[model samples]
Target: MQAEQAGALTVSDKPTTPMQMIAHAVANGAPVETMEKLLALQERWEAGEARKAFVAAMSAFKAKPPEIFRNRAVSHDRGKSTVFTHATLDNVCDALNVALASHGLSFRWETEQLEQGIIRVTCILTHAAGHSERTALQSTPDTSGSKNHVQAVGSTVTYLQRYTLLAATGIAVQGQDDDGAQGQKDQPITPEQVASLQAGLDETGADIQGFCKYMRVGALAEITMSGFGRAVAAIDAKRKKAGSA
Candidate 1:
C-alpha cells in the first residue's frame, strides 16, 4: 500500500522531525516522489510552528520589558562640553539575556567583513522552536579613538552587535534613579524628532559616524529629546563653517 511505503520511506524516531527523516532517507537513496512529499509536509509544519513560536515569544517579551541603566559616560569636546550617558554593551546584554531566556529565546551575532573598512553584524534571535528573526547593521571602523586598526574594527563590531540586537528586540536602555526624572529617560525619540535630525544631517552633509561622535551618542536614533537640539545646533554650526570656507 502507498501508506505503508510512505511510512517506510522515513527514518526512525531518533531523528524525530520529518525533515531530518527525509535527509536520512536521501542519504540512503529513497524514492524521489516520497522525498518530495516529505519535503512538502516539512515545509508546512515548519511554517505553522514558526508562526506559533513568534506569537508566543512576542507575548513573553511584552509581558516584562527590560530595565537598563546608563552605566557609561562619554565626554565630548575635551570635557568642556556635554557628557553623554549610555548603557555599555555588557550592561545592555546583561539586562536582556534573562528576559530573553525566560521567553525561551536567545540571540547570537555573525560578523562579515565587506569591502573597505565596513563591517556587517547580524543578530539572530532564535526561539526554542527553531524559529528566528535577524537584524543586520553595518558600520565603518571607529577612527576617533587612538585605537590601532585592529582595535578600531573590533570596537565597531562590538558596537554594531549591541545595537543590532537591541534594534531587533525593540529594547531601549531604561535609566533608573531615585529621582522621578530618570524614568522619563526611557521614552523613545519620536518620528518628528528623527526627521528633524535627518534634515540637520542633510544640511551639514555629515557622515553618520561623525555626527554620532559630535553628539557623543552611539547612534542617531538613540539621540534623546534634550540631545536633539544640541545635535541640530552642532550640525548647523558645521554647515555654516563649511559655507564660509
Candidate 2:
C-alpha cells in the first residue's frame, strides 16, 4: 500500500518529526531518494495549500459586508448640520478582531510625527503565512475646531488611524445618522469647494481616485458640504508637504 494510503500526515496535522517520511518509505516499499523527493513535494504542496486557504479566508471576510454605525454628529450655524457616519476606533477594533483572528489575519498601526506638525499613519495587515499589505496617509491636526493643541493632534491621529485601517481592509461603512430635525438639508459639494479641491489636487499631484478613497466616498462630487472644508485642508496639507519635499 502507498504511504498516503496508510494515513500520511498533512501540514495541518502538525507533524513534528521525519516519522512520516520513514513510515511512507517503509509502507510504500520505496527507496531513500524517492522518500526525500516525496517529502520535498509534500512541503511545496503544503505551502501552496496554505496560500489558497489564506485567500479563501480573506474573500469570505470581505464578502460579509461590514457595517459601521454613524453614532456621532455636529451642528453648524443657521440650522445647518453635517453628519459624520464614521466608526469609532474601539468599534473598529471590536468589529474586526474576531473575524480576522479566525483567518490568521491581524492589523496594526505605525504613527509618526513629522516636521511642520504633520502626522503620518500607516496601517499594516499581516497574515500568518507571512503575506502582508499596507496603506498609509499623512495629515495635519484638526486645528479648525475648538480643540486645544493636544486635542487637535489627537483628533488627527484618531481620524487617520481609523481611515487607514478601513482603506487597507477595503471595508465600507453603511450607516448614517440623521436624527436632529433641522432646516433645509445641506447641499452637496459646491462649485467653490470643487475648485479648491481641484487646485489642491493639482498642486499636490494627488489622484482624485485616491483622494476619494481617503474620503471614503465613490467620487469627489459625493462629498458633503460640511466635509468640503476638511477635505480641502487635507489636500492643502499634502500640497504643502509636497512643496517642502
Candidate 3:
C-alpha cells in the first residue's frame, strides 16, 4: 500500500517539477545521492526560469520605452563659448525608474579604476527573478574647463554611469543632439548616415565605443545632423590612413 501511494504521488496530470520530484523521493526514502541529484536539478530549473523571466521583463520595458530629453546645459570658455545640453543622471533615473520598477527591474552602477586616469563604469540591470545583465563603459577624466583632479574624476564617472545605463537599456535621449548651439534643428543622423559610418568603421577597424566617446554621443545613431559631415570626414581620414598602411 505504501509503495502504491508513492507511485501515485509521483504520477500527475501536469508535468512534475524538480522540487515535486525531490519531495516524492524523500517520501519514498530515496538514497542520499538521489536527494543530492534532485536538489542540483531543481537549482538548474530555477535558474533557467529566472533567466526567462528577466528576458520577458526587458522586452516589456523596451516596448514602451521611456522618453528622455536633455535637461542640463554646459558652456565652454573657449571657441565662442560653445554650449551643449545633456540628460543628467537624475533625469535618466526619473524618466526610467517607474517604468523599470513596474516591470520588476532595477539598475545600479559599479565603478573601477582600470588604470591611471581611466575609469570604468558598469551598469547592472537586475530582475526580480534574480537574473542580471551588465554593460560597461570606460573613459579618461574630463579635465576640460578648469576642473580640478577630483572634479575631473567625478565628471568622468558620472558621464560613464549615465552612458552605461543608456547602453544597457538600449535606449537613447529623444530630441536634439548634445549641442544646444545647433538650435532646434539639431536632429539625429538618418539611418543611411548611420549605416555609412558603421561601414567606414568596419573598414577601418575602428573601435565603436571609442568612436562614440570621441563624437560626444552615447551611440552612433545619436550623432547629430550637423555633426554627420564631420563624422564622415573623420572616418574617411581613418580609411585613407589604413589604406596607406
Candidates' lDDT values, in order? Answer: 0.73, 0.70, 0.81
Q: Is candidate 1 or candidate 2 better by lDDT?
A: 1
lDDT of 2: 0.70
The parts of candidate 3 lying over 4 Å away from their true place are 1-10, 13-15, 179-245
Report the Cα lDDT for residue 113, model 2: 81
TM-scores for every predicted model: 0.58, 0.52, 0.68
Worst 10 residues of 1 by lDDT: 176-185
Candidate 2 lDDT tens digits, 1-245: 57675454554454444556557577879887888887787777767766777687789788774677655555544444544344577887777888787778889999988655667788888778856666767666666448899998898788788877877777765653332232222456655446556666876889999999998889887777556646865875686578679
The collision pairs in model 1 are none
* Two-way TM-score contest, 2 vs 3, winner: 3
- Candidate 1 residue 53 C-alpha distance from true site, Å: 0.9
lDDT by residue for model 1 (126-178), tens: 88888887776655566654889999888878877877787789877675222
Question: Considering summed lDDT, which 10 consecutive residues are worst modelled in model 2?
Answer: 176-185
Candidate closer to the true structure by lDDT (higher is better), 2 or 3:
3
**What tens-digit string does per-residue lDDT give for candidate 3 at 1-245?**
99998888767533489988888898889999999999999999999999999999999999999999998888865557777888999999999899999999999999987434456677999999999987766555667678999999899798778877887898899874453466423888666557767876887999999999999999999998667656765775686578778
Sort by TM-score, top down from the best? 3, 1, 2
Sorted on lDDT, highest at the top, how do the candidates line up?
3, 1, 2
